[model samples]
Target chain A: MSEEVMTPETSQKVTKAPTKKVTKRDLFWAWLKWTTAVEVPVSFDRMQALAFSFSLNKILRKVYKDQPEELEAAMARHVQMFNTNCDWGSIIHGITISLEEQRAMGNEEVTPEIINSLKIGLMGPLAGIGDSVDQGIVATIPLAIFVPMALKGSILAAFIPGLIYIAWSYGWSWFLFNKGYSLGKSSVLSILHSGAIKKVIDIASIVGLYMIGCLSAAYVKFPIALQFKNSNSTVNVQKILDGMLPDLLPFALVLGMYFFIVKKGPHYLGIIIATMVLAIALTFLGIM
Target chain B: MLFKAFLVGIIYWLSMGRTAYFVSFAFRKPVVLGVFIGLVFGDVQKGLLYGATIQLLYMGGIEAGGNIPSDQGLAACIAIPAALMSNLNPSAAVALAVPFGVLGVMLNNVRRTFNSFYTTYSDKLVKEHKYRTLSYFSFLIPWATNFVLYFTPVFVATYFGSGLVKAFINAIPTWAMDGLANAGNMLPALGFALTLVVMGKKQYIPFFALGFYMYAVMGFSMLTGAVFAVCFAMISSLFKQHDDDEEDYA
Candidate 1:
């Protein structure tokens, strides 16, 4: 394997300007609480709006202490239409809170419209990237590789994906949040410009596809029991297929099912019933 | 039945609440649920086997964008106990879990619809500037909604439905049981099919072919296949980088 693991180009220079009253310690506490309880009160109406506001609750309170009307407005802005891929989306939360802090400290340039626009604008793009990388690759790869072992009755194997997931999700989320908080608005530009995140995903996907292939060959079993008697040779059809290409039946079965699912619409129940019927019919014919 | 009912209810409620991540990570899996149910019923090994078996049926079920294709958690919660009480093997348990998962999906829709009412109420609270009472709508109302949605059905089913399931299992003919087992055997293809649908791209066909042939023809282990894949990824990445360098100069 290649030894190169390219890290994202995160800007190191920390800008010290328009320092706010809300301490970093307080923000840290809220962020920590949010990590454990982000989806606690998840509802369809606000989606993750409640949790988003809840995380910034302390900062909001301190920033708008003297101005009750401003505090109410801030709270109201957070409770609006808000949902995103939670792990990567936490960075947006960090940026939003930092901007809010600056605005509350009477930064004339940082208006309420800018803050709302920032949240709304970033949510969609971030969600798209997060879903493709986090859900599509990171989550899928581990399950594909480890689930086979788990099915084979290894307790330790079953635990691997869950452990890896918790660590990966929390670790990246924490780093992104810190980066966004310290770097403020510029962090967004740096993250986008680096181009390293996309490369990493592309490479991971190559491995993901390969692993899915491995899973199919090993796990998706379709052992044929057909036989033929010709002259002195009583030939087993399954053995002939295996000699030419191992797991041919399983491979064909998977491809057939894949076409059915993708083209015929992904009604899993219908596919299952169809498979059951096929299995029973083949068994009845003594050919499977 | 009463004890199992209470347990299932608690697990279901947690799957939708604050500790949702934990529930999703550890408890929601059919394998884990089986072990827990087995411990409760004094048959840990049986539970483990059944749980693992049923888990394969729902292996492809993933919740993306809050849309649950199938409710594996609910399926596991109900199926494990039902299988345990009825003395049905894991394959039949899978056949049983399918409908429960479907029912759970419908209930999920109902929960989301019900939660919309609270969303409207939240809007009202925000307009009124009742910041203090906002927690009532966000935290209290939705939390309560999940409790009602999840807890009631699980509790009632465990208490009353187990006996009926046992009778149903008793009535199933031997050939039908064999048919169910055969279906169970074929189910993993659907799982792989689902994963393929998500990850499939024409450009990646070579990698898929390499993986399949490496394992099937060369008789390589899964670990070996992964290692080979990584090597190929690295090699391809380097070649691409070389091409980029050439383009930059040109």
Candidate 2:
């Protein structure tokens, strides 16, 4: 815990120019430390990134202020380190520095447009990646396995999901952190454009989309109470069509709820409450 | 009330990761917490199973943006202890757990407001930044507040009269207990739908469909579903790669 907790060195040492030392253990611990029990997704071991960014910025800021012949080269070097280890959060952090510059230039008012853009723009991609990797795959996959075991009376079951989630989520963080710092932006973007990255994304999309569909089928409820009579035409309401469909009903219900939420936003909580109340009432009525 | 509840809450939080993790505290996985409370109160299996089931019923079901009031923490820390100690139906335990946990959330906010209340006194210290004293005061309020509020009640609940508690809950008919268990089991299913909405997308739709179909049709367990999914994805990926190679030439 002492090793993992944000030490003062992480924040302050970077303010003063420091040597760039990267280690595999540093990357490993950075991921493992941040992931211990807390479910704060999208935190990029920022202290580590912060320290690294500080050194790069301190050197670059000096060079840029001097506007030397090697200014572009210096900026390129810093940018290279950044691009290699660059994550979406670090980009935003870098952008924050840019905004501060804009402010210092005497542009007093922050534009509503910039705020809106950050919200509507950054949120979608963050939610997409977070939901896909964080909640959907990492959380869902492990919990899916470990939960039943917990139900089956295993004290050790809870740790299973905890372990798996910390491993995958933090592992990705460490990998990306080191990669971005080492590779720099140009190479990473070039890699992204070079077909290898696209293939990975494509593969991810295929698997990710399929898992979402499966989640939809497994989770959503259609409530397809049939109104039709049986072969005797005796006013029997539970018709054959109710159970015949594999996932059509379930899939539709989740989509319907999603659309409802889209249309109404947080009001759906009320709907859930109402449904729960009605369900309880029906149970009382013997019609559930 | 404060001191006992604090002890209970501490035990509850520590139980979340079963002391595996120390940062920001979370051992809310029901099975682990349940057994801990059970052993502390003396019924190993009941506490384990009770805690775990309550945990499952709300698996990954987060109420983001403050829309739904869920008592996952209370369900883990408080409800299992209350239920197991009282010899109440496990299902009844879950139902009661939610409201209690919600109560805890509400209480937590009130305590937060009290800390805000203490902020009014900060003006005198601000001139010097009284940096060391200010920092100490900040810790003292929350620690003192939570300690006094939770510790005693929890101690009382754990130490005495769990079976005496059974009598009060037993007044509710067995039919009601059955209904609660039925309802509680079904509650987990309700969350799966929301989780699906967040997770589903066009690119990987087939594997999920395949997984669900295998579960519904072939009667596979989640483990089997996961295994089949990995197998299907790998095989399909190979074929897809081959298809792309053919298309490259054509």
Candidate 3:
């Protein structure tokens, strides 16, 4: 299967001027359908497959307008198991659309196998990179910066993080969608392998880590209620701890949870239940 | 009150319904939902406070591969109104949000399971070459299904559950309430800690320490923290680039 893909005949196709053209309007509608419907029909088995076919249904019909048999085959092909990070995976849609157009325009090298392989190949990496960069950095850091302001009674601040996220996702997804259409398969590999993206991820990690710290300090509360009673005076444990490190308990709590996740591997429900039980028990014992 | 519950139900559906996925994703944040939910309850300030507090517990709620770790939207929608109606403190409101957030993941699973029917339907449509009908089934039908799945519980909870929530709060001893609030405060750690795990770079743990201790000592605004963070990241990246250049030279 791998050798078939690598065979010289199937490697690259020469560009031909004669074509069934997909106009900008057609692509826009396709993208619109994609963005809106991508997750709507998501299932346990096929995932976004129905939505994937739904988005391409019109485009497929138009491209294979002269070939009804081909159009039906195309429809059947798309509604197979499909899932990926929505915005980042727009590139896959772009690539698929362009490839279908080429195949419709008589590019024999653009086989069904090649298209399916490309989608399968690209989705995982893009999903991994997209989820972390988009959700971990873009969606989160803004919330860290703005939610405090929202807490302080600023209505605009409440919407700003979300606004930034919406803008970034739409803008980036649309740009990538077009980039995929024009550049086809080669561009994604280049973009993925590029040092620029790595640098971006590195910087995002630093900024994200730092912001998580700031947020942790600002948010996580673990105040100790223990006190040392003496003949002369009572020493407040919380105040003494505050005097040494203002949010020491919170810091330790965050570290404890982080290490738990690292060791136990993200069993969040267990962690949450344990934390609740522990807090309630400590409160019962007058320890926190 | 019924009208408000209905509107809040719509908000939940809009946010979690997966329609216009990115826009819905933004709208679903507790802070954002707080604003809308506040409008329904006629107390934007109180709603924002409760919502923002709840938001902290979900700050790092990354829905990687479309599997939400918790449903912050459901948590906020259900808990905020109950908190407002009962006048629960923000910390206690956060505690109220947690169980609802966990419950929401179950609804998501059910919705996904229910949607499996569409796959078989879509396969038939393609075989029959009924593309138009397939498109409707793909988006609109599934979305309507989600409206039922996402909206009903929220509406029922908001309209009927608030009274129960208030009574439940009243029945609980003050010590238990205080403990719940304390738990609320500590729960934000889970979000941040989860984020640390997701960020997945052990070497950068120092930056987190720097940010935490810096904030602990200086206590500057988040924007100021961001500026400092960016600068630190840039300077470190510059050193990294220099090392890369030397490696190229070697």
Candidate 4:
């Protein structure tokens, strides 16, 4: 994993004609195009698909590097490269390269590469955190709040989340990308050795775990019930559990689902269908 | 009124139909299409609000291992608009969306079928060197057209369907009205509870109790409580590093 990054020696040389007098309009279109490209899913192995957009950026630099008048266009072209090449890979990598590339004009070339490794090490764990925060925490909480509020006729209610998330989602992406890149561009190697990445991963994991707990409560939708009526008494077993707490039955259900998945090796996609069918079938037999 | 519903459906299909799920998959984030619906129905704020609320209702709704969650996109787009358009209570709006969410699963299957054809055609196109045609058909044009086909029906139906539903409810006998009303009020909580059970993990029972107590006993909404609990857990987690690191030692 610490092997040196592929460098300028092998940088794919662009032969496309110079971006013909690229303008502000070209910049917008460039951003839009790359953002859309980045939208496509890539093979898990390499967010290498980002290479396509980054390559486009390189081509832009080649064409516009000499034209100081086109510098802003080139910069927009760079950020727009993200939009088209916009996977987590590109976002993270672009920032790393942006930092390294900036520093490279007068500094060590290897600095960017070393900076990327520690940053790269952080990516998977960050993915865990990013996925949890963006997909789980930020999304679900606002959504749960938004639904009821909208039900109540508050128009401003929805935008509250948008404002919050646009900031969080875009902010985190931009922050981490730029932060990772800037750090990578500098000392590059010591960042990881500093224990900062470890601390970051540790914090993210803890948050992710708590989210799993919240996710358990928020997402799972079952409760246990054992109803018994003697000559003079009645009980809901679920009520007893509920009295103990909200998620006992839920925890049990998840355990059951997890075991079923783990032990049975249930195919992930088909498991829901199979379980739903089994539940329905059991209900038909008056067993569920 | 029916046309309005149909129009809404068309619009939703256009925006979300062709590639929303995949688009979201790209970002690994749900589209929050509810915000879009809220805006369209002259209640962007309300729509977004409702969307977030339901987001919790399906937090574990992932497509991991091919598991299709209740189609949240369809739920937000259709159910939310139905709520606004029908004058049905928002609770009723949510109630209406549940069944339709299940229907969305069926629609998603239909989409998969189309993709299969697209895939097969790609092979044939490759064999014949029909690169331009294959790429165009495989990726772009089909989704563009299907967007119209999928969204139009939904908008149209919401306008008409909610009206029809309103009519159907009015036409229902008084005796059934109480039952329906009671069911509407109880079902979501039931659904929420059921969902909690569906996605549970061992040793996480207490949090559920906290959630249940917040909603059932303390009169706090689950969202507020969940947020509180999550934050508390986060803070505790920050402080509990000794414990986690100790576990790492184990």
Candidate 5:
């Protein structure tokens, strides 16, 4: 049994247990191994809690080899309801590990209550931030760039964006995990509070919206081949629409679909089915 | 075909809900699945074309708040294989894929509900200090559950349904197939519309208009439009930051 070192000034109890040996390499490896598994079998009950415990399995085993009660406590702490952005959520894992390790080392300040509260409190904000960045920005940028290419039948468009996103997300998550481990809990808040998070979200939303618009014009091809015969000259409806505005039908169809999907509140399947029926009817009647 | 379907079903299960990071990315999207299906059918180009067309139908289906509105991967797997086996046009394949996507949503819900039982068991295991067993409950059990859910339907459909589908396609009139193809062409508008619904707000409608005009009227390429959109995003963000700073000083 190693003696506990109490630092009065920092209020951090350092446990000098000889068996407790979790290196930085171990934390990184755990993150790589467990990031995806964290969401597998994610339930409404515990969310990612079980997977979190699994990720910290090795560290917990080493840190509390002699302290069975504490080991049990640590496992139970992580099994509570936890949900957050899957990739960015690894920061929580890193921070929790640090706290658990310290607690095992005789840090009375890092209680189960504190750890649980920190996790519950931080997850929502981190999810908000992570969703905005990962889904809104990181995911969207590559998607926006490659989607049009894919639409044009370019194979590279399909593979490149996904690969880049995977690589970028992997690197981003690894970096955040290390940061959380090194900075502990308090400094994580300072990083979040810096206002850059807001800026990223704002910029991402703008770009995402604009690119979608571009996608609608470039890819959505809805043409009405109907024309009216006039006394002097035959009028082409599609040509007239083209003269008035390029891709007018596509634009309107997109907006109508948007309104129907968002406000009309039919399930996506219903709308898809309805569109098929309407399309078939229109094509048969030569009205499309 | 049965072997391929089993593999695709497994791919769908792994990519959507199972463990493994990069593997999921490779198969989750229809475009990738299209390539795989094409490889299976010995027609990579047609598969790519079909997959891309189907992929457009789901370009906006972002998984938000953990609710996947449609299962594009499953749709691609089922649709591409069926279309290839039947010699149907890619456009008709998009329409054909929709039902499978809906069914996938239902199955996904069931999978989620069933997995909840494991969470309870995990709680008991932790209490019992059965630490090692947690990994099995967390990873393996859910995986097996997903494998069973996905593989069964796909295998049955592939083994028994292919000849029936080919006969059915052979029996259908040319006009009906054309109608279906037309419907498929029009369906993409719904996807684009859905994208706007998710990402567009009234305030940001101008950017949508800007993107549309730049491409539709100015005849700018998609790449060019993207560049302009990026520039606009940067400018707007900078101006907004300046305004916030001014408010702070005030």
Candidate 6:
């Protein structure tokens, strides 16, 4: 099953254009426009359709300069409801650009249906993987490391994480963008199915999980301020708990929340409100 | 004070505006925003401290599918400035940030709803072949709409709401204040736990347990923890590769 999925036939059927109209500068401008304005024109009806079309507007016009009817159709097609993870979704744009370029250069095989289906099919999986890797690891682990330093009055520490995120996003997205453009759609499938990407994701997951664990231990704070009073002496319940395990309450608190999420789905507002109310109630009862 | 508030509003717009999303994403984190907000208030260290404290609540704030769990940028932009003006403690500042974070989500929805207008307008431009004007409608005009949606509340809150927050904080009793602070501390767990769920690898949970206990036992710096994490991951993957190789041979 794995082998079948991994090995797609590597056949390059599309004939190369004798002289390409779409230049390197055109591709660069398309990428720049896509990256900058992808999220700006987002709406409820069509999340990123306008921005996606905006990125390709000039390029589509350039590609089909003589064929105004085709250009109009292409423009109309791109301005449909399109949404995905911003950086990882660049590959979709690259593929779209290439397919459009080919169709303009008169590749009859690259149908409009093919272009739309490829985009719709690819966006969800890429988004699922991209959101986890980008936000879960690249954006987060740095915060886990540097936030403590920022607390200790290091301003540079605060900026470093953001810088790391920016660099990774731009660098990786641009790389994928170029790859998608050069490799075209079929190679993208093979690349997605490859074991190397899977291994990379696995490694990243472990690292991300480990860092989150450390972050939870260091940051999540719940203490048992409760105590037992006797006539002769007073017993500190928190101290007794601490003797058994340092940060026991905090650990339990984090796990309890985790299980709550697991069982009840992500109704975060309720959880937050419940936590605040419970904390306040516990404080009132002198048990927190 | 008006000028400072206006500057803060602009910062909020820039961070939440989603213009050059990569840059804005980096700009929006409370810790980063803390420095800028602090600069406006003339105390970088305090701002950093406040921003970092509030940031803990949102460490795992993953906005998957363009749906934000909470608006951390809005939280920081409002709370940091108010905390700066009113001399609120770090934990209290965190407590203050939570509500605003929630509020920011509504504003985001509103911005999205407002942007629907542009979609129809773009269709009109495309029909008429006014391609040049369509480009403006796609980016600049929608961005300008966001400036109004994102910037005003922050400006008003900073300029007018700071005094109100100070008054409200003063009115609240000491016990409740302590409770709020305690709640603030506990809230960070939500972020971490949410990340765990999103990671969606139930089998790798042992790694999380290992990391948590390891940190609890020997409180290392985050950088040190990362080094250990990378090594552990690499070693584990190496073992997995061996297993895969054996399977392939079979």
Instruction: Give the alpha-carbon lDDT of every model.
Output: 0.68, 0.46, 0.85, 0.45, 0.72, 0.85
At residue B152, candidate 1 shows an lDDT of 88
i-RMS, every candidate? 5.3, 8.8, 4.1, 8.7, 4.6, 4.1
| TM-score of chain A, every prediction, order shown | 0.69, 0.52, 0.81, 0.58, 0.75, 0.83
Per-prediction TM-score of chain B?
0.81, 0.62, 0.85, 0.61, 0.81, 0.87
Candidate 3: Cα lDDT at A6: 31
> How many clashes (backbone N, Cα, C below 3 Å) per candidate?
1, 43, 0, 61, 1, 0
Clashing pairs in 6: none
If ranked by DockQ, best first, what sequence of candidates would result? 3, 6, 5, 1, 2, 4
lDDT by residue for model 4 over B122-194, one digit each (tens)? 4455455344464354335546655654666576667557667677656855434433223222223323322
DockQ of each: 0.38, 0.22, 0.56, 0.16, 0.45, 0.54
Kept native contacts, as fractions per model, are 0.42, 0.19, 0.81, 0.06, 0.55, 0.76
Which number leads on DockQ?
3
Instruction: Give the candidate order by descending lDDT.
Output: 6, 3, 5, 1, 2, 4
**The candidate that achieves the highest TM-score relative to the unseen native structure:** 6
Mark the regions of model 3 whose C-alpha exceeds 4 Å error after superposition: A1-19, A228-249, A259-266, B241-250
Please identify which of the two predictions, 1 or 4, would achieve the higher TM-score against the true structure. 1
Model 1, A55: alpha-carbon shift in Å?
2.9
Candidate 5 regions exceeding 4 Å error are A1-16, A136-157, A221-288, B170-205, B241-250
Instruction: For residues A1-288, write the lDDT of model 5, one tens digit per residue.
Output: 224453574333333455575687789777965776766777766777767777887788888888899898888877778887777777888888888877877767888888888788778767655654555445555665676677677778878767876887778888888877778889886776667755665666677667767777766777676778878988888898889888888788778877777687647667766777877777777777
Q: What ranking of all candidate models by TM-score puts the best one first?
A: 6, 3, 5, 1, 2, 4
Which regions of candidate 2 fall more than 4 Å away from where they truly are?
A1-124, A178-243, A246-255, A266-268, B1-6, B14-26, B62-69, B98-168, B171-183, B200-210, B231-250
The stretch of ten residues in a row with the least summed lDDT in candidate 2 chain A is A38-47
lDDT of 2 by residue, B1-250 (tens): 3444445656753432111222222245565567666776677778877877677556645333212234465556767777765666767787656445445545444444554433433333433334334333333343455554544344555455355446646676654544444445444433544544444343444565565555555554566655565566666666665223211100
